[model samples]
Target: MKKVSLFVKAMGLGLLASASAFAQYNPKASYEGPAKMNTWSVSIHGGPTQFFGDLREYDFYPVGNTNSDSYSERGTWFVGAAVGKQLSHLFGLQLGANLGNLAGMKRRQYFSYFRSNYQQVDLTGSVNLKSLLFGPNKMKHWKIDGYTGIGVLRFKSTAYQLGSGRVQRFTKHNAGDGTVTPAGYEADWVIPIGAAIHYEISPRFDIGLDFRINHVNTERLDATIGGDNSSVYDQVGSRGSFDNTLARKGSSSLDKYGYGSFMVTYKLGKNAIRVKKENGKYEYDTTKGTYHLRWTDPRNLIKPPVILTLEQIDSVAKANRPKDIDPRLLLDSDNDGVSDYFDRQPNTPAGSIVSGAGEAIDFDKYVSAALPGIACAEIFANVQFDTDKNIIKPQYYEMLNKVVELLNKTQCRLQLSGHADRRASDRYNIALSRRRVEAVRNYLVKAGLNDANRIVIDAFGSFKPIGDTSRNGLQKNRRVELRLVP
Candidate 1:
């Protein structure tokens, strides 16, 4: 079994190494910096046990010989935390620890049925991960990894068979005297070896659906078939029995079982990149070998791959099978690190940087609080035009005066977009719209927007409707909108 497991590991690692080589350099020119390196994740997993030969718990594990039948270990569950690094676009590595239950085997006759249980408990102190297949780059929503490691496990097991249904504090020898007593029980420690497959749902969050199997050697509990005149034999005591009854060795009594579990983990910190000043500008080599840094860059390290066992990967993946989205978005529309559902403002325009609340922080103000972004009225004017011609009407001087006030008070960039109704040809509408937007620009310039270059004008040509395509809607649609941006 160990040889087979080793062969599988060799194949998996070889494939991942080959793939990572090609996948590393495939990023497009638009991808900035060395991509994010590592991730933090957490999860839980469990499944059934398989009893081996009749060696029993005592025969295999540390439990000693006893009158009680060998009891198998029950299944187990564990929750764990991990830190991972993307070795390449499609390959990564993770190190983590887990605490959960595991199961071992047992042999016993209970309630008229010969039943055995396998159960063990453990706390994962360490684990290693290596990804063979990673989720899509644009999506970064799903990924799978194989992992394994040795960790200390705190374990125990109990062995028992059906006692009298009635409570018995002690056995009555010739119990025509109908009094009863509760039966006694015993337990012991048994080390466990376990593994699983794991998957990540997102950088900070993950889902693991896994099956872990553990082997347990137990203390032998004899199954006496010989009929004896001894009370220890119960019914068999009443009947004389034979010498053919056998002894099940501890190794033969050893058992195997599977456990499955699920868990959720949260991570804190930023996935950053590092830049150093070289010849007055930032430059550094991103080679595979490690090097000491002259300066600090939180994101400089290209993370290495996770190196783990396949069995561990499967177990972890099974534990984290997601039924629904984990409430985190792979792509944030607001450019706030937080996802949309969690972000209070879902509709913040794209490319606009935002706060946790999704509120757009003026970029210029975001850069420096002292530099207050240009005020609203500085770059806009209600430039009324002639009813039929796209010419600025002289009657709107009062409205223009306010616009002039803003431009003089605060220098800002102006954006003017014009629209027209569906009454004219698309070409004619575009021409008229251009005149309308340009008229507003020309006025803003006269009112001292400072540079004509800072003013931008665009025409929609009735292509972008503000309301319904009706007479009233047309009136609203055939208007110009102005905005100020820093």
Candidate 2:
């Protein structure tokens, strides 16, 4: 009982340690993390088994003799199959079935031999060492797991008296019990604890070596317990009534057996196994059972060339082009050497030697016209503006049209001098005056003026005010004056 208590404590501590180690595993750091829910695997294994019981030799020699030939046989075989589910990276559960034969003999007190065929069903809790200790990594191709569980064992045994060559099949109620009713075979509770190490050859398959020990609850497994008139012998009759021959002193220790085997396991289910390629490397996806192909170099992917239409190309070219030159500076309507702004006569005959007016003139006729001292009083009109406004009112249109008519009738250039009130900053006033000049220029140009270049502008920006210091006077100051220059 003390030993049993210690073993249970050891197992409990081992489980706590396993849980601690499992808690340390970080799934995000693992190359391939835990399997998804319902992931399953099936395994088959077979190997030699050994039994330790009261009927077997305690040492290499027989119980009360030095003869080694009287020792119990040591060789037997067992085959088993199991189905398991990975509940997490660190833990899982397995259900297994095993079929095997057990045999033992005693020679000193009563020569006896018992051969039994047994079947067992077990359910175990399993822990994966690889996942718990190191987490999941691609380099870890080997996995070790430990498992422990309770199960049921069913057996049918036949005992033999070696010298007489007599066989007696033991039934639970009749063979060992001195009763007329039969109790069939024996079913015993067992505890199986073991470990296995596996090498993963592929995502779907693995091979492993397993070792396990099963602790049985009953001491009657070999059909012989020591002591004449023992409780077991009294309950069930001794074989052939040879009570003295068959009975020996019994001990309190129970029987145990174990096996060392090799197993091959295959993962089951559509999502039980998979491999994927990511960032130029292969990775196993245990959840989806699929593969993903990734390119290391982006250039490996095919791409179409870009093409542009003529209209689109033109639009792009225009967006990047420089602004056009001012037309006023370059105007030479008569193909004259002098620009239109300085030319008095813009329409000059081609190849004619003209004066600065760009007109073909007789030298003597130019002196006579100039000596008469042409009475040139400036013909002008002042177009008033609203305070701080550049828009030309409808009443000012007639005055601007008269200026336009005068410009068409004579070889004269018009000067538009613009002004603003002293209400804002000097810079703003300067800009306002410029806008007033441009407004008048645009109106005169639209009113049938043959050449807009004939009109020039000067902005005073309230410096040349022709009115008094009053509100009405300030409005009058914000005006453009058209002065004709001959």
Candidate 3:
């Protein structure tokens, strides 16, 4: 049984270790970009520890080698504290100390006049360490979790009587008085295995209750009339009967001395992780400026305040070449937020909530109800861009048409935008993005769109991305987006 138990423990630890290691590789990719980074917590527990394995009960019966003598609890009750790290929402590890009593006995009524109380001082060493296992979710102020672990236990033991008298008492002392006292002894190593349930009170503190039994694999523990050490001589004052000691040999004892403990531990320190959301995307540009493409009022060109880049023309022209406006103008000559006047790159993308000058806005609400050109009221749809280009594509015609239709019908305003994947220079992409959007604005104006006041332009200059750009990232970077608002 002992061998099997040891094997089971080893296998369990192995499994937990394996899971602990593997679980981390699976990061929450879907997490909403911003999260906090660290946290800490604590626990307490108590219960009964039964002496199992090879415990010997001295029987007063003369007929058999085994005599079941009577005895009471010489010592019992355990307590401890722990500190640990939360690896995730579900797992953690802790270190603590085990302290308390581990004694028991039988009543020595007939042969002796005094009551026997076995007592022990578990001067448990710091080696007592434990692992934690939890069920369900973890890491919330009110979250409940279950845990279990193993550790090393060390202690000592002693016998105590009701009176200050040393030997067997000849009479009973008055009850309810200090006449009855407790004596404590010490003992060996113990293997403690137990379980507990805990609650996180806050990010840095948690409180819990635990119950576990410790198996002190030793004897010479029960020191009462029924125990092995009290001695058993003849009626004539000479050595007679056999030794009734319950303590075993080999690995100390074939039997085990165990105790149950309950404890409360308050943890200290800050140690939890929180993901935080930021304002910008990872792009290639540094300058701050807006871009332009077609005018939003489709019926007019608004003839862009900036020039369009090659990528920009390719985006809208696709299989064709520049018909009216020269493509070279796409290269901004003036660093003036606008592309060489009348060129497309003008206002940067809208809804990009910026600091001082640019901030990315949270647009989850306005896109569905407001006018197409409103700024930063709601999350706009993800607009796909041309390959390796921040340029708006003719491919976006359908989606853009939807926007145009919505704007025309509502006679609403709009802020145009531009974006570029990481493949081109920040300046090039930003400029291209500006021109592409200006083209859209220009087309809208020609298409009978009316509101000029409702139209605004903002260029992010290759900063935010609709998708990832690392190889498979192009699909992410290549794009433009619109946040609608009232």
Candidate 4:
């Protein structure tokens, strides 16, 4: 009893150590973290139990002893249930219980047979073979586990004769060494080792097959000692000195049984299933909320970091960078509406009203002829703005007032195209330029210009720069051009 208690304590400590190790496996990625995994489950199984001992006649079939009344089938049925907890993707623990009957007979050496009904409980550790070898996502719906454990078995056995229906008894005198217990139910230790293959049908349940062999610690399980001489003793367990003539050592062979069962497991907790995208990538927690620890490997769940070469990085930067300013939008040497590329007169006087071709126009003569149905001359000038400022300066007010007077006198229209420097984003610059245009147009309306609708406006942000974006050209680029149309 003390040895069994110490073994149980050792197994408990081992399970706790394993659980600690698994709990500390924190992945770098938060999405692949194991904190939300489903870890608890329950299972039920039923199958046939095959007993192996000294009373067995054949390996799988009871053949030679069938003619004698001592013949007994060596196979019986068993039912069991278990509850498990998955500590990690690679390791788990299960506590299971089984009730079964065992039978075996032999007629060659000894006309003896025994039947036993047994119950056992085990605490086993399971190793996930599938996820350990392949990745978690490789065989998403299948699981294979190998397990081994120690437990206690309690059983009652009855030994009988072939034709006489007489019960066989073994006392301390005839049994030799008194190792065999009296004829009744007895308790002993057992070790179970086996493997299982499971197929997950859904998030909640799984179906699988399990095969295990239980090694009992006692040789009295069949009520017949192994290697007992049949020629010397007419009946089984009939002599105290049988070991002297026995072919093998004293009680060398222990008793064991095997169970091949079909099992169904139900998983408990929120089990997140993986979703496969059209691009052949898998995502967890899209359909369900949390992953099951039984099938999820923390390392495999992490998404690989994207890697790019230097050339690829440079290509992306070039593709998204803002385009260069149009040279034609700049290169106007004079403050005229025309660029130098198209300006016939490249250098006009400052503040001079210029035509579309950059030629200075006679403002008074054009205004007088335009009153007599003569068309008004197209004149252009620029209103400069400070960096990021939408306020029209006092110096440009005089020029604007003259244009307002011309608009009130003649049926002429004013076109204002506003611009800004490249110190800000395109969206912000466009809004600043629009504000500048509105300021100038409001000033014209307050200055008694007729038909405020005659003013047309356009706001072009840093995209259409009239000069380079350097210190000298910034103020020039941040200006509104005024074009008077007939």
Please tell me which predicted candidate would have the highest lDDT against the true structure: 4
Roughly what TM-score does model 4 have, to 2 decimal places? 0.54
Q: What count of clashes does model 2 give?
A: 6
User: What local distance difference test score does each model get?
Assistant: 0.42, 0.64, 0.41, 0.73
Give the Å shift of residue 145 in candidate 3. 5.3
Could you give the candidate ranking by TM-score, starting with the highest? 4, 2, 3, 1
Better of 2 and 3 by lDDT: 2
- Summarize candidate 3's per-residue lDDT along 67-127 as a digit string, tens digits: 2343333334555556555444334456666555443332332222112122322211111
Worst 10 residues of 4 by lDDT: 240-249
lDDT of 3 at 254: 39
How many pairs of residues collide in each model? Answer: 94, 6, 120, 1
- Candidate 2 lands at a TM-score of 0.48
lDDT of 4 by residue, 357-400 (tens): 88888765655455633345678888888888888889877777
The top-ranked prediction according to TM-score is 4
Model 2 per-residue lDDT tens digits across residues 1-486? 633663585468457645643464443432123332335788999997777775575534323322333533556789999988654556667899999988767654546666777899988877776655665544356778878877899876666654443564353534445543232467777888889998867667789999998887666666655444233332233533423322222454666778899999887755443334579765444335522111011111224366989998999999998998665456655543345776677767642334455555543333234422232234434677888889998976765665555566556677788888888888898899999999889888889988788778899897866556787567667778666567
Ranking by lDDT: 4, 2, 1, 3
**What's the lDDT of the predicted structure labeled candidate 2?**
0.64
In order, what is each prediction's RMSD in angstroms? 26.2, 19.7, 23.2, 13.5
Off by over 4 Å in 3: 1-4, 7-14, 17-21, 24-36, 42-75, 107-150, 159-188, 223-486
Off by over 4 Å in 1: 1-36, 42-140, 165-203, 216-249, 271-486
